[model samples]
Target: MVVVGAGLSGIAAAHYLRSECPQERFVILEGRDAIGGTWDLFRYPGIRSDSDMFTLGYTFRPWTSDAAIADGAAIRDYIRATAREEGVLPQIRFGHRVTSANWDPATARWNVEAEREGQALRLTCRFLFFCSGYYDYEQGYDPAWPGRESFAGRIVHPQHWPADLDYANQQVVVIGSGATAITLLPSLAAKAAHVTMLQRSPSYIIALPARDAIGRALQAVLPRKAAYRLIRWKNILLSSALFQFSRRRPAAMRNWLVRQAQARFGPTVQQRDLQPRYDPWDQRLCIAPDADVFRAVHSGRASIVTEQVARFVPQGVELASGRVLPADLVVTATGLKLKLLGGARITIDGQPLQVTDALSYKGMMLSGLPNLAMAMGYTNASWTLKCELIARQVCRMLNHIRRQGLDVCVPVLDTDAGQTRPALDLSSGYIQRASGELPRQGSRKPWRIYQNYLLDLFSLNLAPLRDGALRFARRGETPR
Candidate 1:
């Protein structure tokens, strides 16, 4: 068995795989020198998770910290500890980047090629699990603006935040309105002379820090398992109710959210820039604590510029509305480009697999693929929850194969109905651009990815192993 990636999801998958199949030979391949993939990579100022740590942290291991919103270092430490405690570190091979993988129908195994420390290596395995996350770790979205090179000022992407770059007392212009933009604005406001958030469009912003007095009290009183369960359920319910309410009665949700934003900015600042045109939840809502960004704006530390970038001038940026914003630094928080299965080049019997042409089975397995599965999490909820459930299901499938002497398990999608589904309803440019390459969820159970945790838990974790859609057969039992 082979696992690609050594991040939280990858480590979790390996941990579970070890527990279930202790005698099986397996190895984890990580491209980086260390574990904690995203946590180690992203080191921007004020970097932290948008979601609460309770739900974001693993269920098997509880996060016993006072701060619900943990910094990058803390999260990194937690992941490292989990890996060490679970004995997953010994099975990982660092500095290994998988280039491509091919399936051999005759041997019923995968032949994977990887580059490790500038040398090519090959491995054969019966199962290949990909946990390499969605974003491009090498280079973030650095769009080719007209005069990006001509700009005399320093420019940076959040993905590669310089360790020694100074922003003190300098005017900073942050480009984009996604989570990174919102996070950067508040932190930069305290040190920079002034910060301007340039947005092509508005994003839904909500405010709630991870740690509150109430949350701490609950954690102290309840057992670790019970507390984690309570917080997970709480977040799931709260997020779902808000999302459903926004969808059902968008006007009301929009008005309430806007009013909250206005209240944070006070009447004067509200008139200038607190109003957003689109309905609430039209895009993924940005979360903060008590409208922190709005407060920064009201305090005259930060401001928002709602205009398209006409071009990049030597001094700064020119707007489409015939305005120019001068800055000493420009941070492009534009967005990410989603890559299907971490851009792994996949082929079966010498035929390449175009992700866009394939249909998803149970949002995990791809159609026409045998004995292979990928972990894809929810866009609406914490990624770890979905990943853990999928890991469990994969284990069950593996167990069934071992018990029944089966060499292959394939998930076949029903194409006879002539129906299709969209991968996501997000308006983010990255998601929109890569929608074709992404997988679609089914309308029925097991195939559908219910963003809700309780429903997915019952369907994925607790459900019976035998299902009609999934086909398990011994070698030579089915025609290849």
Candidate 2:
């Protein structure tokens, strides 16, 4: 077995595979020197999760940190600890970047070509699992604007945040409305002389902390397992109910959310920039602790400008509204472009696989692929939870294959009756732009991503292994 990426999903998959298939040979090929993928890469001041650690942490491992919303360093430590505890660290080969993979029909194995420390190496494995994340690790989105090179001011991207770059007593302009932009503004306001959040459009903002004091008090009194379970279910239920209510009655939800923002920012800020034109939940709501961003604006530490960037000048960014915001530094937190399946060139029997042409089986396995699976998580919920579930399912499938003497399992999508629209209906720039590359969900039970943990826990975890959509074949059987 060959698992690419030493991140959360990859580590989890490797741990499960080791336990389930002790006799089989397994290797983890990680491109970077470190084990934690995202947590290792993204290091910025006040870097923490948008979601609470209760739902974000692994199901098998409980996060007993004093802070429910863990910082990047804490998350990285957690991953390392988990890997060490599970004893999967020894099997990992760090700095081995997989270049390409080809399947030999005669051998019934994958010929994987990778580079480690500038030397080429090859490995053959019966199964291949891609847990490498979606974004481009090589380079994040940093587009060049006209006269950008002439700009004498400092420019930075959150993806590649410089360690020595200081924002103290400097005028900063953050250009973007995504999570990164929202997160940085409040933190910068504490030190920067003035901060301006320039956005092309507004996104829905919601306030939450690591954990509420009330939640903490209740947890202290309740039993450990019972407290974790109750909190998990409460969040799941509340989030689901609120999302459903918003979708059904958008106007009411929008009005209520707007009023909440108004109450936080008062009349002046509400009149100027607090109100958003689009409906609530149209895009992902940017989460902040205790409405921190609103409070920062109310205290006159930060301000927002709703306009498009016409171009970048030597001094600062010029807006379409004919306003030139002077800035000593500019940080573009625009967004990321989705690269499907870590930009892997997947082929089966000499034919390349187009992701859009394929259909998703159980939202993890794809059609027309043998002994191959990829993990894609929910945008609505914590990503790691869904990923952990998929990893367990993959382990179960591998175990079943070994016991049944099966060599290949291919998910077959009947295009005539099976094709349907996507599951998520959000206007995120990344999602909207890359809709063509995303996998198509089925109209029926197993193929859809319900975003409900209860449904997925039963369907993906407890369900039987034999499904008509997945076709299993023996070693000598030919492709039909």
Candidate 3:
């Protein structure tokens, strides 16, 4: 088995693979030299998980920290520690960027091509697990503005924040209303002369405490592992309830969210700046730890401008309403560009695999793809909530295959499965932009990604392996 990436998902996959299939040899391949994936790559002002730590952390590994909302460095260290403890770090090939993978039916193996430095390397594995995240780390999504070249100020994307670039005492303008923009406001406002968050539309932002008091209380009485388990489940239930509430009663949830912000920002904060144009959960809700963004806004250190950018001038962005916001620095938090399997080219039996043409099977494996699985977290809930389940499911499937003496297992979509939907139901700009490039999801069970953790818990983790959609075969035999 070969796992790609050394980040949270990869590490979790490695840990599960080692424990479940101890006799099987495997290796983890990471493109970057570092151990952490997104946590390591993103070094913005205040990089942190939008989800609570308990749910985000792996089920096997308990997050011991007090901060439910941990910073990027802490998350990175946690993953690194897990890798070290699992003893999989030594098996990882850093700097190896997988470019292409081709599965050979005759040999029942994948011929993988990867690049290191300027040279190419090759390897073959029976099973491949892609844990590389769904975005490009080299560059973030930065749209070409009409007059971006004319701007004299330093422009930086959060994905590529410079280490030496000093923004202290400089007027800064951050464009976007996503999690990235919300995180940057509080952090940058502490030192920058003034920070302004400019957004074309509002996003639902909720403030959560940095520390989990209930979790802390549980830790004081129960065993560390027990407390963690309790807290994790509690969070899962709460997150699910919130998502269900948003779906069933969007108007009420929207009002509650706006009121929550109003309590923090007082009456002066405009409704248009906090009230989203779309329903809650349509796009992800931004988290403001301890109401930090609101505190910054109320303190006059930061401000929010709800408007579209007309063009870039020498000073700052000129609003479509003819308002010029003067700034010494500009940060584009415009969101990420989604990539399927980290943009790696895949082929099976000399036939090119167009991901968009394939149906997503259980959101982990693609239709008719043998011995392959990907770790993609839930868009509606904590990523690790679904990722941990995926890791466990892959491990279970691999063990079952080994026990059954099967060489290939592929999820074959039935033509009668009914209508297909977009792979993701997200209305986020990033997801919508990449809709044509991602795989499609069927309208029925096992062939569609339910997105709900509870439903996925049964389908991916506990469901019977011999589902009608999945086909298995021996090394020399064709799948029946």
Highest TM-score, which number? 3
Q: Report the lDDT tens digits of candidate 2 across residue range 153-183.
A: 9989888889999989988999988788888
In candidate 1, where is summed lDDT lowest over 10 consecutive residues? 267-276
TM-score of each candidate structure, all chains considered together: 0.95, 0.94, 0.98
How accurate locally, in lDDT, is each candidate? 0.80, 0.78, 0.90
Ranked by lDDT, the better of candidates 2 and 3 is: 3
Residues 173-240, model 3: lDDT tens digits: 99999999999999999999999999999999999999999999999999998889899899889999
Give the per-residue lDDT digits (tens) of candidate 1, residues 213-302. 656777889986787677767777877788789888998988787777667767534343545667776577788755678778878989
- Name the TM-score of candidate 1: 0.95
Strongest candidate by lDDT = 3
User: How do the candidates rank by lDDT, highest first?
Assistant: 3, 1, 2
* Better TM-score candidate (1, 2): 1
- lDDT, candidate 1, equals 0.80
Look at candidate 2 and give me any clashing residue pairs. none
**Which whole-number lDDT from 0 to 100 does residue 345 have in model 2?**
70
Lowest-sum lDDT 10-residue window in model 3: 412-421
